[model samples]
Target: MFELIGIPPQALFGQLLLGLINGSFYALLSLGLAVIFGMLNVINFAHGALYMLGAFVAWFLLQYLGLGYWWALVLSPVAVGAVGIVIEKTMLQRLYKLDHLYGLLFTFGLALILEGIFKHFYGVSGQSYTTPDLFKGGTNLGFMFLPYYRGWVVVLSIAVCAATWYAIEKTRLGSYLRAATENPRLVQSFGINVPVMITLTYGFGVALAGLAGVMAAPIYSVNPLMGSNLIIVVFAVVVIGGMGSIFGAVVSGYLLGLLEGLTKVFMPEAANIVVFVIMVVVLLLRPAGLFGRER
Candidate 1:
């Protein structure tokens, strides 16, 4: 078999597939961050905790309510999203007039509180979530074996990302959202409810995180720390992609994921820091990010 850089094709393909899967999660989470920051102007440090909540909610549904994977996929996001609505109305809405640091600090404290509560009740140990029977096997793809669930994750994530991009970039509602972000007072003068829109936008961004949590539950050990571990990487992605640039967030997410995967194969010792390294380089070269428009 032909080899690239002395690595076997199987190993290379396997790592690439793994990278793509990781990238999907990054894209989803960062997309949410971008959306929230764009319209609500909040950093949403509690996003990771909300993601953890989504996974726990799914587990609870199955454990106590006799629901299954499919049900969790549909309900978890909605439940978590409702929680987001409450948080926005009662807590986040009050911080809009202050410096952005206030929003960041508030959400950071919220994240800590949420994680602490979960740790108190569930402990630090991870819980297992079974893959649905529908995605129970793997298919041979010449060089590597692709698990059905992983493939589903990749496909579904791409579909969701694409759909979100279209909705925000190409639709009339999206135009209104963009306009509101640019000038809430002007939009409000037109009789549009800007405050409610801000609230809903925050909820929607968090719902994306909840959706990703459901997708991740079957693959990762569902734990309080899972989202926290991934969230930092996602924040790096958002920074590299540009704070409020939707397209930048999605593209840079997958790009960095693949870069990280390649680094693992080439320089295993640097795998963890590769994404940040690239982020530093990108910032030096184009501070506005690859897809971000300069203000």
Candidate 2:
């Protein structure tokens, strides 16, 4: 059967695992984008740059501060999130009353500035980050070899995604956020500081990107351009999932990742463009996205 398909089970399953890992990142990043767009109405092009910052911060902690992967896991996201809070309060807040184009342009410029600074300082070369000691090995799963750290990444990502979904969909704080986004004046009248909520929501969204960066550092080379390469695909994921639907973003991310993996197994040459192709199809069929409701 394997020969009939012209591929071995090991290779198929291996690609699937890799796809899941990539999907994990997509889900996390797109979730952040969805939250920010849904609440703040900003495109946030700097998200990828902030992601890079997270990985670099992790590298800096290990290199200069004599810290380890564990510390990086905890601190990197918080540090980048702090930067996000500052940007939101000082710059992004000013553009909120303006056209959405202003927000996109501002973040695009911010991304360029960030990427330029990092490239100049760190050089274009990639940095290495070792997997944590606890997750340094692999397991034989009868059919395929599973790396402990990779497995941890998938599990942790799923948990975080689920937690975020729950918070936004079911919690009191989420209710306030949703309400404020829909009607800031009314929500403000009810004594819920809408501005503060927006600020925190942006921070939280960026922090999710940072967390993904930290998770990715050990798996891929920590290069300045890493996020730039990945962000486009994530944006495509967002479009396919629908810009306004959180559930759509998460589900489409994983599904597309799996599809991409299958594409690699079946047609290696088409793998790179498969996501975009699917995005075009999805847009044509359902402009509001699979889970998005028409406004």
The residue-by-residue lDDT of candidate 1 on 93-211, one tens digit each, is: 99999999999999999999999999989988888999999999999998788999999999999999999999999998898899999999999999999889888899999999999
Model 2 CA lDDT for position 202: 96
For model 2, name the residue pairs that clash: none
List per-prediction Cα lDDT, in the order shown.
0.91, 0.92
Q: How far is 278's C-alpha from truth in model 1 (Å)? A: 0.7
Q: Per-prediction TM-score, please?
A: 0.97, 0.97
lDDT tens per residue, model 2, 63-147? 9999999899899999999999999999999999899999999999999999999899878889999999999999987767889
